[model samples]
Target: MRTVDLEVVRGLYKKAGAARLKLDIAPRFKPGDRVKARNINPPGHTRLPRYVRGREGVVERDHGVFHLPDARVAGQDDRPQHIYSVRFSAQELWDAEAPSEDSLNIDLWDDYLDSA
Candidate 1:
C-alpha cells in the first residue's frame, strides 16, 4: 500500500475545485415556456424522477449549463446541457382530485424535455 502525501492530495484537490461544464450554446426553453417530460426508463442510472415522466410543466428558470448526471454515472460522455426549473401543477402530475393550486418544481436537463 502506498501512502499519498498531504501536499500531493491538496494539490490534486486544488486543481479540480468545483468543476463546471463549459458550453457555448444557449438554452432551448426559457422561463414561462411550456414543456413536457419524456417518458423514459433507462436500465442504468438516471436523474429524472419517475413521477414526473410524461408530465407537462412550464419552464420556471434557466439554471445554466451542467454535465448530464445520467451519462456521467454510466461512465458515458459528460455532455453539457442547459438545466431548467420546471413547474408542474399538482393536478397534472397526480390524480384529478389533487389540489390544482399546488405545484411541484423540478430541475431537468434539455434532452429530457419537449414542447407541450
Candidate 2:
C-alpha cells in the first residue's frame, strides 16, 4: 500500500486557497442594490434554491469571484462569477401573513440575479 505524504496534502490545500482568492473580474452589483433571482427551472443541476427563484432582494455584500457551480458540474470550464449575499423579507418570499420580522439571506451568483 502507498502512504500519502502530509506535505503533499498541505500543498494541495494551499493551491486551492490561492485559487479561491483570485478575483480577476469586476462585480456587477454592489452592496444595497436591488436584484431579483431568475425563475429558471433547468432540468440539470443548479446551485440556486427553489424557494429563492423569482424572488426580489437587496444585495447585502459581495463575496467576490468564484467558480459557477452549475457550469462546473456539467464538465465545463471554471467560469468564475461574482457571488453576493442577498437579503429577502419574509413577505417578499412567502405569503403576506408571514412574520414581518422574519427574513432570509442567501448567497447567489451573478447569473441568478437581475436588476430589480
Candidate 3:
C-alpha cells in the first residue's frame, strides 16, 4: 500500500472543490476535554508526529468531519475522521520555560488522540 503526500491532497482539493473530498467523522470528545495523542508507530507511516505522541492537551475547537488521511501521509480516504483544534500549553508541549498562558493550537485527526 502506497501513501499520498499532503501536498497532493491539497492540490486535489485546490483543483477540484471539496466535493471531490468526502467529509465524515464521529467525535467522541468535546471542547475543554483533556486528551493525548496515541503512542503508536505504525510500521508503514503516519501523520501524527513523534513529538506530539503521548503529549497531553485540551480540545479547544472542532473543525467537524473530513476525509480521513493516511496517518503517515495525506492520502484521502472515504472513512470519516474528526478534526479537532487542540491547544497545548507551551510548558506542557515542551519541558521548557513557557508562559503560563501561552499555548499552541494544532489540528489533529481523530485517531491521533485518546481520552487523557
TM-score of each: 0.82, 0.84, 0.70
In angstroms, give how far residue 80 of model 1 lies from its true place.
0.4
User: lDDT per residue, candidate 3, 1-116, as tens digits?
Assistant: 55888977777765544532344445878998999988888765566777788899999988787655563254544456778899888888886788788888888878889999
Best by TM-score: 2
Question: What lDDT would candidate 2 get against the real structure?
Answer: 0.89
lDDT order, best first, reads 2, 1, 3
Candidate 1, 42: how far from true, in Å? 0.3
TM-score of 3: 0.70
Residue pairs with backbone overlap in model 3: 24-80, 45-72, 46-71, 46-72, 47-71, 47-72
Q: For each candidate, what is the lDDT?
A: 0.89, 0.89, 0.77
Q: Candidate 1: list runs displaced more than 4 Å.
A: 1-19
